[model samples]
Target: MFVKLHFEEWIKNEPGVSENTKELIDEAIICYRAQAYRAAYLFSFLSFQNLLKERMLVASCPPGYDEEYWKGIQSELRNDDKWEAKIIECVERERPAQIFNLSVDTKRQYLYWKDRRNDCAHAKSNKIGVSHVESFWLFFESNLSKFGVGGGKEALLEKLKVFLNPAFTPVDSDPTSIIKEIPLTVDSADYLEVIENVYELTTVDIFGPMKTRVWDEMFKLRGEFLDQLVEFIKTNQSLYTQLLKEDPSKVRFFANDPAFIRSLWYEMKMDFRTYKVIIGLLRHNLIPREELNEMISTVSSNNNDTFFFQVEEPDLLVLEESGFFSEFKTLAFVDMKINDFNWARENRNIIWHLIIRNGFDETIVEALNNTMSNSFIPWRLRDSILELFEEFPKLKEEYIDVNSRINGCLPDKLFNSN
Candidate 1:
């Protein structure tokens, strides 16, 4: 009955293990199942040694590889008769550099397995059994992911750039075919750099169209690695602004996870670019209603100004649904935007537009009543704006609850008779 073993099935499915390594391991597993205990031990020991050595030689030495010793290992691996000895020697030479990333415990197990292999190969009296083979198999499974090669970020990027470029890579190419090679080969820091590199392409010529494809594919990175991609988008000032510009389809993914939404919210920067992107992300009702309260909680904690002048009336209405917006907060933000000396008449128009759309309550009306005019816009235009608001019944009250200028600006109304 030709049934596959559990470990054999797992070996086939493990994406981190190289195909060459898996084939080598397959031989060992077959022999062990057949009760060829000595052969199994010999094959198991040699296969792992082969994996480590081959991974070392893949596509040039990555950074942190001991160049001198790497050259020595390269030379020794080429010689058929001495190669196996060189592997054992490499493991023996482990301590000073410990380049394979093996921990103290795994290294100890390797030495123990080597002795067991010697007994099988040298015709020693030591009896080989299922336990010996099983232990070796377990050790192999536990440690295989750690043995990945190409351990340098720069080297990884140098290679990734090649794969990401559409000219060199075929349209039909499964990026996963290349990405599969990336998992253990690259570090988390390398993952972040990869995302940043891809993003820079979007903002430039030649590769702009390809950026989304690359970005969408970047989501393929599993588990903790995916966080790096999100972090890059959330924390980067330019990218924070640019999300509004990214494919709208991505918002579902961006706002998908509660933690991700919270993270994106918390990372919001105090700038128009970040503010616009956050507004865009909040649109289309893509954010789950259940998560809105949490996001509102996030919004309340933010101490920065909302820059609401840029927002439309309907958008403010949308944010209000999530409990993420309040008249008081908008007024405060309105206060800040009104006060910034850099903004001119055009800015004031936008501010008045938002206030009219939301329709002022007593709090907003009173806030406006107490607000004063700034030097940025001429007091006449400010008075015109106030007059426009006052024509509506809600804002008909006389301005200025205080006689003195508020925050060093002139009275909320410079003209009284109108």
Candidate 2:
């Protein structure tokens, strides 16, 4: 809820705060304010569960385990039916002595509040009063430092004062005031710092009207901003590479507008890294379908097969899901060479359905004919072609002559028949 603005960026930026946990806290705050005490208690308890799981994950894993490794642990915890037991097991095995540096009394209070939360969550007829909600808030307030809030309890109370008072004005409300101070022609490093600062200052209200004027202004300056960003990426290769390796989605703000994304795609020289950025944009639907098709067409026409294949290979499902059937067909048939038979066979199941669904039967027939006539085509691939024809009886009529020509031979005897 908008009232609890203090927790917005704090929860989002905390390494221990999973998105699910943040969402639970958001729901809990909304329900608590709405006087839906039972639902509020349940959501708060669920958030506590997530918090414990995150702590366990952090405490159990050694240092230098990358973001992806932590993500895997988080995902496993989410999917595990006995996650509570798993957390307990992790705590016992890992022996995490301290959690956010709470005093013993505060920890006891947290446990007591957790028990009350459980009672209200599990009992259908349990009545949760405002006292219980206030008690939980007290527990939460006492442990503010554990979640990485600075200035200790005084800062927590100060933020709470703003939450409780309607007329309280915060300096962060209009981030544009800060953004405007940064010159349009600032150096790349300074520009990146400004972008990061903007991201940190902006917060989305989960249950209220969207306020994105800061981001809107940034997007309006996409040409200048993206040019600087691309330059920064080029100049600072290691930092940019690290950001991508850790979390490529961090740069998704550039992909929020399709026209800007198209401009970015055109302005930057194509490379493996640029291709990955474009793929991330496409996955996020930041680039329009038509723009994506055009980009793919241009890449293929330029004989940039390596870039084309790199873009299409990992993102075939993304392309299909985005309904880029034309792009999918182009990637499937245009640049694919006979030497890529093993790659084709590896994804034959998905490719087969895609071909049939997109009405590329004629293309497959021609490819099969070419494969059969060309002696340079591997015998194993020749057998694969026959298998494809047999799988689709409708294509049998078209490829019957080619199949007969490659039917019985010394090669057929050497290789197993499909």
Candidate 3:
């Protein structure tokens, strides 16, 4: 009865129509604009059902509204291709109620809200907007209320709120999918585990306690792992080395390879995947910044394009200048450690200056304690440090004392503990 009255009021508002048929036309217009073709059809079909709900139809009027009247409204608008006739069929077939139905799975509702509904409402299409989305909810809510179903409005509302919020946006693709797609070789997991363990060991308790045995095992494992990886690459591509020179894109056989697992290990520390991918691409003479950007976007769709920081040429140049990239890439082959005070003295200026600059004073201090604590003097890079001391001895002394404090040279609260 309410729907009929509402329908009548809507039609009456249509221009150039008799007051009697005006309500019907207005209802059709609502259906047409909302793209509720199926609902329109059903509304026409169940015109009489409105009487039953209203507890009316005392012999003067038939028990229901005229199905014929609703049908004519639908036929008149059938020529519009934008309005699907089956909308009526769908509404009738589903026969969903207007009120909320908490018993129904919310995940289904959430999925529809997050994917289908959101897509329709926001996608590049003719029909889009908050009102359009709200119309569907209203249709369902009205029908559901008749069946005494209720409460999913909150779920629908939550999704609407998220869609409207500036902080959240849906991603068309996922980048971490690549991480999941990477396949592990038989020893790949073990190899990575060993490398991680060794890396951890290097960071903890100076290399003095178990240095000899640990170093031997680490080097041995590194050698074996490298050999196995190289062999795997060779087997996958006959022209392993040449792949680097010719076309790295063609060598994407490693997309699902064990190297990716190792790459993952490094990636967790500092997004080394792009660098590794870049290195692989350079080897193959195929660089696709666009593709790389897509990968980044897929994984992290913030839309700010901040991952641009990773692809920046200047940052890459700085890393190269600092030798950080070379050091990481060749970690397995090199024996790099602050061996003694003399070594620290030789490398102190540039090394410690970099350490402070990067805000890694604690790390450098820890390293110094383990390696250069015993010696009266330690490494300071060539003549540079000496010149610094001569140029400004007081400042140099302060610098040394501050650095020593960082390295835990004293037991006072003037450093990391403080």
On TM-score, the leading prediction is 1
Weakest 10 consecutive residues of candidate 1 by summed lDDT: 398-407
List candidate 1 segments past 4 Å from native.
16-19, 59-69, 94-96, 150-181, 186-418
> TM-score: which is higher, 2 or 3?
2
> Candidate 2 — number of clashing residue pairs?
0
Candidate 1 lDDT by residue in tens digits, 30-78: 8987899899878878877877676665535545566786787788788
Residue 305 displacement in candidate 3 (angstroms): 35
Between prediction 1 and prediction 3, which has the larger lDDT?
1
* TM-score on alpha carbons, each prediction: 0.43, 0.32, 0.21
**Candidate 2 lDDT, tens digit per residue, 195-227?**
544333332231121124344434444434555
Best model per lDDT? 1
Model 3 CA deviation exceeding 4 Å by range: 1-238, 245-253, 259-336, 340-360, 373-401, 404-418
Ordered from best to worst TM-score, the candidate numbers read 1, 2, 3
Per-model lDDT: 0.59, 0.50, 0.35
Which residue pairs overlap in candidate 2's backbone? none
Q: Report how far off residue 30 is in candidate 3 (Å).
A: 30
Pairing residues by index, what is the TM-score of model 1?
0.43
Error of 1 at 214 (Å): 5.9
